[model samples]
Target: MSLSGKEGGCDCGAVRFRIEAEPVVVNCCHCRQCQRQTGTAFAVNILVKPDAITVLQGDPAPHEHPTPSGAGQTNFRCSDCGTSVWSIYHAAGDGLRFVRAGALDDPHAVTPQVHIHTTDKVDWVAIPDDMPSYEGFYPGREIPAIMGEDNAKRFARAVGRG
Candidate 1:
């Protein structure tokens, strides 16, 4: 489905944004770093091409933090409310963005296509039986199957793999 024109903002409404295109994929990450960063059991991130999102209002500040890859990640948060809206992993450079799904005006508009880093998930957390759960990152070879042919091509192009 086309997710174009979907709007969202920070908690304080200082930063507003619009999605200009359909997302490549949605990932529910259960890694310890994801839990600690979000202060939750898991983090739902909407993956899209860098240009897919457009800022409608306000400027979000970027904050860099450590990552397993040592290349680090940059999280963009509202300057006013300090609500993280999205992130750019150094590994992906400027190719892709990991938008916080919870920051969307209609968070439920998207659902996790895959669950990653499940090995570090909290004991009380349970993934649905039908969801694709991975102990670590999902295999690159499985992208086509999980994201469909079109989205997989988009993803590959976004990450410069195509």
Candidate 2:
């Protein structure tokens, strides 16, 4: 699962990223924010170490939002494209970094291990086969792919542990 040289970019190609290692916590998020931001039912996010994830092009900015849980989560975005390339969450004194899953050049390399925020998930959306489910958010992807620690804390916080 070591990505080593995998690369991905934003929709307009204004922003690009390089993953030096395999992602740890890659999953499809069905939260309302994800649906609104991606303009789709869900968003795929790849969690990797900040050190492992390198933005190859223009620097992205963090768009901060107060989640329903009240913890602060920052979506790292491309200033020009306004694409939420990544997100960082700081909660309980922890940090996690999450990359937009679809942003990867080879998205097939990773798959979501579970579904979260089922309560807010759209009624028409159906869960996948064999993937685990959580009524809310899982504390830590607790796997290799949940990249930036800051982002994980934010995710956990967003799920109400912040």
Candidate 3:
């Protein structure tokens, strides 16, 4: 979906942000870590460049958390309500950020292009056949096709991909 003027904030409105560009891709991660962190069946993340998001309000606190892979991620959360607004994985460093889809003003503006860690997905969850589902992470080579070509290129550049 187009993200020309997409905006969102914490539940308490302490922190607000705007997405300057279209997201590189959306993911529905069923990893156990994501489940425990979100306290849900899964988490939907919009992958985008860190600089692409413009903060229009208060600053959110960044907390370092460990993933199942042992690598870490820093979750930026609202200082007031403590809601997770976004996260930056160590693998991507500061170049990429995973914006919480539920934190968006219009959460439906973006949808998952792929479902990862499906093996750990809830038994009641049903995945659409139109979208690819992987027991683990999918290959980066196919990301360009899943996401728009323009967004994919921008993501590659941000993550230092050739």
Lowest lDDT 10-residue stretch of candidate 2: 139-148
> What lDDT would each prediction earn against the true structure?
0.90, 0.71, 0.87
lDDT of 2: 0.71
TM-score leader = 1
Candidate 1 or 2, higher TM-score? 1
Candidate 1 residue-wise lDDT at 40: 93
Off by over 4 Å in 1: none
Q: Kindly list the per-residue Cα lDDT of model 3 for residues 46-158, writing each as its tens digit.
A: 88887789999999899999876677999999999998999998876578889998898999887788999999999999998788888987778877777668877877787
Candidate 3: global Cα-lDDT? 0.87
Tens-digit per-residue lDDT, 24-97, candidate 2: 56667788888887888888777665677787898888788777778778888888888788887555223446
True-structure Cα RMSD, model 1 = 1.1
RMSD of 2: 5.2
On the 0 to 100 scale, the lDDT of residue 121 in model 3 is 99
